[model samples]
Target: MTIDMNTLDKAILNRIQTRFPLTSRPFATIADELGSTEKEVLTRVSRLKDAGIIRRIGGNFVPGKVGFVSTLCAAQVPEEKLDLFARTVNTFPGVTHNYLRENAFNVWFTFISPSMTIIRDNLAAIAEKTGVRRILNLPATHVFKIKAKFDL
Candidate 1:
C-alpha cells in the first residue's frame, strides 16, 4: 500500500510521531509550528488516517507508573486458526500490541492490566475462546524503555 503524501503530510507525521502537543488544541498547535492552519492539518490528518498511513494517535505511558502491570504473551496457534486467535486476543482491552512471528509460538502480544491476576484470567479466556491452549505469559523482571520515531 503505497501512499503518496505531500510535504505537509510528511511534516505532520514527523511532528506528531514524537512530541505531540500537550494542549487542548493539539492540531492547532501543530499547525502553528508547521505554518499551516488548524483546519488544513485536521483534514490532512483525517486523510492520512483513512489511507492507513496512521494507525492511531494517542499518548504512550509507562504501565507500572500508572499502577498497571504488563506482560509478553505468546501462543502456538495453528496457521489455520491464526486469524481467529489474533481476533480473539484483540477483543481484550488489555492487549496493547499483537503481531505474528515465524516461530513455534507464532502469535505474540503485549498485555497490560491493573494486576497479573487479570492478565492471567484474560489469557485463560483467550485460550478457551481460541482453542489454543499452549499460551505462554512472560512477565518482565527488568524494564527497558526506548524512543521509536520515524523520520517520515
Candidate 2:
C-alpha cells in the first residue's frame, strides 16, 4: 500500500534533516532524539523511502568551498517547444536537477560550474541550441532554505 503522509512521516523526515550520526550506536542516538526505538526509526525511514514519501536522506553541500560554483536557473521556454528545449538544457554539464514548474519560466534547474563565466556560456549554449530568443540567468545571489520536514 502507498503510505499517506502523516505525523510519523514528518518525524522520520525531521530525523533525516540532521546528519546521520557516525558511531557504533548511532541508531540509539537517533532513537533518543525521536522518542522512538532504534529499530522502529530504521524501519520507518525505510518504509518512507519505499513509499516515495522520502526521496533521500543526506546532507547538502556548499559548492564554492569545494572549488565549484553552484546556482539555480529558471528558463522561459515556449510551450510548443518542451521536447526541443529539454534536450538542449539537459546536455549542459553540472545540471543536477531539472523540473518543470507551472509558471512563466517553467524549466527550473540547478547547475554547478568551475567559474562564473562558464555559467553564462552554458546558458548561452542552451539558448542557441533551443532557438530561444530570450533567456534569464538568475545565478543565486543568496541561496535559501527550501527544505523542511512538514508536520503532516
Candidate 3:
C-alpha cells in the first residue's frame, strides 16, 4: 500500500527539500525556521523513516571538485549471484551507489576513484572477484546538469 502524507508530512518534506542550514545545531535551526522544536523535527524525521518516506540522512564528498574521480559501470551478474556480486562490489571503498537496472546489464553501480588508476584497478578487482567476464565501463559521455528544486 502506498503511504499518503498529510499536511505536516508535506511541511516536513518541504523543509528537507530546502538546503539544510549549515549550523552546529542544524535540527534546532530547522525547528526554529519551520516553527517547531528540535525534538519535533527529530521526531518527525524518525517518523518519516518509520513510515518509509525517508531512506537515509547523510552527506557525501563534493563530487569531481574534491579530486574524487567517478564513473558509471555495469556488470551482467549471473542471476543467482547478483546479490552476492553486488555485495562484493559494494565492499569497495569508492563505490557510492548500486542498482539493479532493467537493461541487459542488470547490476549497475557508481564508482568513484581517488584517481583514474585506482578506478581501473578497482574494476579489475571487482571483475576478478565476481567472475564476471563481461563488464561495461561506460565513462561519462555528457553530464546534463539539473536541479531538484524550484522557486515559486
Candidate 4:
C-alpha cells in the first residue's frame, strides 16, 4: 500500500527515524524540532501508524553488551498453518520481529533473551505449540555493519 505523506509527515519520518528524543515528552521534543504542536505531532504519528507506515516504535539495544542473546530464527511452515504459526510465535515477548518470506524457510524472526538457554527453550516451546517440523536458529557470529535508517 502506498501512502501519500505530506511534507510534515516526511519531515517527521526523516527526523525520528534514527535519533528520537530521549526526553520525558519525546513527542513534544519532536514537535518543537518540527515547529509543530505536541498534539499535532501525536496526531500525525497516530495517523502514520494507522496507515501502517510505522510498523513499530521502540528501543533497540546491543544484545551482547546488555547481557542479552539474540538470534535469527526461520521455520518452513506449511501454507495451511502459516497464520496459526505466526500468531503462536507472537505470543512470546522475546520474539521481536516476525515475517513471512518467499523461500523454503518462509517464516523468519528475531528473538532476544537474557541467555542462549532461554532462547533455545522458547524455540523448543514454540515448535511444540506451533507443531512446526523444523526451526532454524541462526545466531549472529559476526556483524560487518548494521543500520536501520530509511531516508524519506
| TM-scores of all predicted structures | 0.92, 0.59, 0.75, 0.91
Candidate 4 clash pair list: none
Worst 10 residues of 4 by lDDT: 140-149
Runs with alpha carbons beyond 4 Å of true place in candidate 1: none
User: lDDT (CA) for every model shown?
Assistant: 0.92, 0.77, 0.77, 0.89
Candidate 3's C-alpha runs over 4 A off are: 1-4, 47-52, 58-62, 149-152
Model 4, C-alpha of 139: deviation from truth (Å): 1.6
Error of 1 at 39 (Å): 2.2
Off by over 4 Å in 2: 5-8, 24-28, 32-40, 77-96, 116-135, 144-149
**Tens-digit lDDT string for candidate 2 (68-146):** 8888888888898888887777778787767799999888888888987999888888887888756676676775666
Judged by lDDT, which candidate is best? 1
List of clashing residue pairs for candidate 2: none
Candidate 4: where are CA atoms >4 Å away?
Answer: 1-3
Error of 2 at 126 (Å): 6.9
* Candidate 4: C-alpha lDDT: 0.89
TM-score of structure candidate 3: 0.75
Q: What TM-score does prediction 4 earn?
A: 0.91
Model 1 lDDT per residue over 32-66, tens place: 99999999999999999988889789888789999
Ranked by TM-score from best down, the candidates are 1, 4, 3, 2
* lDDT (tens digit, per residue) of candidate 4 on 8-99: 99999888888889999999999899899999999988899999899888888888889888899999999999999999999998888799
Candidate 1 minimal-lDDT segment of 10 residues: 140-149
